[model samples]
Target: MALRIPKAELPLEVRENMVQQLGAVPENVEVTWHSPKVAQDDMEFGGEVGAWDAADASLKSFAQMAVPALVG
Candidate 1:
């Protein structure tokens, strides 16, 4: 879903490792990063990064939420 990672909190290497384990590139999946300033928005918080089934109902739910959040 909408995943907000503070770049300062996660080093590039860690993110790269996660991407490899997830078996997807950043372009292949939905993701977003926010600076501490923009991160203050109420609508942009608690985004999580993890593996999700492409066909799972829960994944769909998060996708729905993530797409719009990232788009707007």
Candidate 2:
């Protein structure tokens, strides 16, 4: 039988912030947030890592999306 995963619920404020920034809560954010402390730290770290502006935005987005698929 296939396993069923439960839906993630973010705090109302966090949900609103994520939606405002991304247009929706990304599945990656939900999955990465399985633990509150880890999720908080991960999101903060992701913000820091995502702030480098030298690279072209389009290229960086493509690379970020591609690397995970390639690795997996």
Candidate 3:
């Protein structure tokens, strides 16, 4: 059987998209916080800060959804 994933563990954009498309996540779904630090770290050494900026943008979009904790 397939295990359901948590909405919070998903990328903010992905969670937003899911909310837009599926209305809601099922009750059995697990959840976790999405840390922006992780996003920044992944992009910090990419020769420039563009990746980090993009990650921030994603977090901003998530903030609009009232899920600011998604950023950490």
lDDT of each: 0.49, 0.81, 0.52
- Cα lDDT of candidate 3 equals 0.52
Instruction: Provide the global lDDT of candidate 2 against the true structure.
Output: 0.81
Per-prediction backbone clash count: 0, 0, 1
Pairs clashing within candidate 1: none
User: Lowest summed-lDDT stretch of 10 residues in model 3?
Assistant: 25-34
Runs in model 3 lying further than 4 Å from the true structure: 1-8, 27-72
Better of 2 and 3 by lDDT: 2
List clashing residue pairs in candidate 2. none
User: Candidate 1 lDDT (Cα, whole model)?
Assistant: 0.49
Comparing 1 with 2 on lDDT, the higher-scoring candidate is: 2
lDDT tens digits by residue: candidate 1, 1-72: 553543344356646865787664343122233343443342134233223325767888898999999999
Residue 51, candidate 2: Cα error in Å is: 1.5
Q: Model 2 compared with the native: what TM-score? A: 0.58
Candidate 3 lDDT tens digits, 6-42: 3346566756865786696433332323454654454
